[model samples]
Target: MSEYHLDIFMHIPKTGGMTLNEIFKKQYKLSEIYDHDSFQKKMMNMDELTEVEKRNIKAITGHYFYGIHQEFSRPFNYFTMLRDPVDRVISSYYFLRDYPGYEMVKDMTLEEFVVKGPEAPNLQTLMVCGSQEIPDIEIAKENLKTFSVVGVTELFNETLFCLKKEYAWGDIHYTRKNITKNRLAKDEVPSDLINLIKKYNALDIELYDLAKQLLNDKLQSLTEDEQNQLKKFNLEQSL
Candidate 1:
């Protein structure tokens, strides 16, 4: 890995990103990492950071889109986690309904939120493609190709193993964060509501399918010893 290269973690909300962010905290020094929520409170945007500030930082993590690399002059690689569109949308709705600064969605039912919630449709595509207008799957796929790692929430431990190997990271162990308690499982949702979510998130569904294939391909490429190591890691975590 190049010492000068920046590691940009594009954290898609409700995609097991919080857990990964905690792992990132263990990997880099406090001064070397730029956290989105931390800087947003200070009203600082990525583009506003000085050259010195940018150069000193090693990793950037937050609910940011893909185009943040434009702010830096040095080499950079992006890594992000994706989730099943239906589950992600459901988790997001329940989490945000009670979350602060989102009072507008407090009374909306799942169906209502599926139809009208802000940033509800094709969120993954929007984040990956960095498009504020219509989200384009082709653009998202092209951008995903450039990511050093693309992880799926369904295969989270595998994703972490990949990250550990890719970055030579230490202490890959972690506890889950930002979980939505009492949330309904995808199967628990009414069929009609599920279809509505699918209608709104068609692009995300497609993107997620592609991401899963990519992750599987990456896992398949691991050497035999590496596969055994991954199995051992999972077993240790389960114990």
Candidate 2:
């Protein structure tokens, strides 16, 4: 019944993706969803899925790169949310410190983490470009065009409105998840550390700015009545 055979959610870390994942759980039956931790925990890679399993899957959500489309035989759509690089890096550092299996970062300073932490710089770009090495912004931008919707963490409500329209999803309401309460606010971080984050995430900063423009354009494309509906949605969420 859906337009695409499969819908892929590229869950970039520290980008408010967990909230979206929760909303996704409500939209699809557990059997229809292919989550990395749930349905495919034993598999080494997505390529291990049998043709029958792939065909039956309605949605796939995970911290995966953009190229997963190569593994599918049917038409698919990709959607993801990105965050400001500086804020994302800061959040990731603190969140990983407390997260199991990431004990390596427990004693690392923010500055050390920014310079050498895993998936630290231009992570959004890397995910989009599907490269572990230095990411290509142009390639990332080109790949972004194939996505059905691109959302930004800073414009979360607007992103939700777009997602609902794009997928005809029901009951988009959700509570936040995986929040890093111990992280320092961006303003509270020292100037040198802020600059250090920027220095390493320059490409991400550019990519995020472009994503914001794309999201804004999508918001502006809504009809007057639809715009009013989005406004009402925002108002309701605020309260």
Candidate 3:
């Protein structure tokens, strides 16, 4: 491992990443930060960057996945958050549907979206597996273990506490962003469609399970005082 001062935040879609971005912004200088969406016109291959550009970037974040780690000469620690597979798929579907010019999913019904949308199958697995076409579940799980922290979206407060401990992060504060406005309630979604989503995203479901286990283990390891501190922070964050 190269000795690196950098941190790579793998911002998986609809995984509470937008909220984390607020925390990152407070911690790192604007120039040191590289927001892939705004700063990078397209996802540039790691080889495309000059050494100077790489060195200047203290933190990097995007929807990209596992393989980018190979591009950095300096040592870097990675962290990411995973959400419940079903909810993540639903959120992604609704969010993209509304994006102007991304009309392909806009007209799709929830069932149709789960059945045919581009993001329907194993997205998180494919991302971490570092292949768009053929994802390897074992590889994704192993890659996850290498992260400084792998958090679960449902357990946001505890996840943030783990981040604070693992990376010595300060300002574990955030406000939500990129919310899917007027999303359907859980009771409104049909059971059959939900099953179809589960069947299609089996690999993502497995990967999410691994993330949950990792996060749960971390939380269990904390002292009672630390856990209480995290609760206090979460309360403050809510305000």
Winning model by TM-score: 1
lDDT of 2 by residue, 60-144 (tens): 8999988877777788899999999999999999999988899999999999999999779889999999987879999999888
For TM-score, candidate 1 versus 2, the one ahead is: 1
Clashes per prediction?
Answer: 0, 0, 0
Cα lDDT of model 1 by residue, 100-181, tens digit: 8999889898888888886588999999999877899999999998899999999999999999999999999988898999
Q: What lDDT does candidate 2 reach at residue 87?
A: 94
Q: Candidate 3's residue-wise lDDT over 23-134, tens digit each?
A: 8666666656677644444555556666787787778888877876676666788889998889988888888898877699888987888777876678899888888788
Indicate the residue-level lDDT of 85 in model 3: 86
- Evaluated at residue 132, the lDDT of candidate 2 is 78
Off by over 4 Å in 3: 1-3, 37-49
Each model's Cα RMSD: 1.6, 1.7, 2.5
- lDDT against the true structure, per candidate, is 0.90, 0.88, 0.82
The best candidate by lDDT is: 1
Order of quality (lDDT): 1, 2, 3
Of the two candidates 2 and 3, the one with more favorable TM-score, higher being better, is 2
Predicted structure 1, TM vs. truth:
0.96
